[model samples]
Target: MRALVLLACLSVSCLAQRPQPCTSPALMTGDLYVSTQSEKLTAFAKYMYDALGKRIRLREVGSYNNKTFELDVLLLYRQGVVYKINHKNSTCCKKRLCTKFHPLEIPENASLLGQSVLGSSSGPGQGLLVNNWYGDLQMKKGTAKYLSQVTEFGCVPVSVLYHTDQSGWVVTSFYNNVIGLTDPQMLYPPPFCQDARLEDEDGEDPETFFSLF
Candidate 1:
């Protein structure tokens, strides 16, 4: 009887520990700090989610080694706007690039629900399994695509398992990333160029964030 009771208690504890989504939309607007590490490199990301007006503004600043990248996206459900800035300052000469994309298109079935913003969990395993999906634009090729996956645990996002795509797969884990919201932006693109805007004349680049690492 004690063993059965302990098993029930453990099951309840496990369910309670699973990451839960914010029940309130107001709670969804904040900053998410995500850090990732691979065999050869590490990346840190700061994501700002603002539920402002009738649109959602998502800004991301990612860094690895000497390369830094920024993404500013305004989402209006099925359509949105995007701005990308990538800068590198090292012995390879300082280069800053900015690309502007207006009326950015989203997939017909794009959605952001059941995503973990501020949560954590522990289990009787080496790591957790998770899934993720997001729309990303290729900085160099000026392309965009929806990358979806059901792989392993990692935090750029704590988990992205609410999407409708099931064909993508990858494995990842978090080095150190936090889930939360922020008001003032933390990281931003460097101030070197003023009007370095370019239209999306070359079409969208076919690069997903998952494919990079």
Candidate 2:
């Protein structure tokens, strides 16, 4: 009886120690590595996020249309505008940003998969402990789902796998070297973008568009 009682106590203790869902910081800067399976494209970018101000910026270098390209994308949700600047031609295009701000956070309805160490845990402070969570994204169009791995302590996003019927199932993003937003100006559109021509809106759903990246 005593042995059984001890096992029950241990099980309860483990359950109590499980980490809960969490939200990320309001201001953050990081490197984003993205892979799109359908396009056969891989991109490396520096990202700036301001959840409080509903702004995001990405400076990306990748291959597009069989050519190497460098682009800067600025999303200003509050102003409902997006700026896409092509470095090779020094041209910018302005489009309507239909999506709302979506933070790097674990949804409250997400199911906790498990807890594990990202690296070797045999030594002290040698590995990061993370929580894996999976959930379906609530979208207005096609089906969407996501799996996220975040740090157990600060809930800092480590990686995410997002899928949608329109875009296919093989988009992955890795986030690293993250820190608090260093410069507020990084979120603003560059001076050259002021003369950007407005493009015709494609009538894409806001939720579907945001989930692509």
Best-performing candidate as measured by TM-score: 2
After best superposition, candidate 2 residue 186: deviation in angstroms?
A: 1.4
Pairs of residues at least 3 apart in sequence or in different chains that clash in candidate 1: 30-181, 30-182, 31-180, 31-181, 31-182, 80-104, 142-204, 142-205, 143-204, 143-205
Q: What is the C-alpha lDDT of each candidate?
A: 0.36, 0.76
Instruction: Please report the TM-score between candidate 2 and the true structure.
Output: 0.82
Kindly report which residue stretches of model 2 are placed more than 4 angstroms away from their true locations once superposed: 1-16, 87-90, 195-197, 202-213
lDDT at 133, model 2: 95
Q: Which residue pairs clash within candidate 2?
A: none
- Top lDDT: which candidate number? 2
How does candidate 2 score on lDDT?
0.76
Q: What is the TM-score of each candidate against the true structure?
A: 0.31, 0.82
Q: For residues 53-138, what per-residue lDDT tens digits would candidate 2 score against the true structure?
A: 98888877776435566767788989988887776676788998776677878989999999999889999999999999998977
Clashes of each: 10, 0
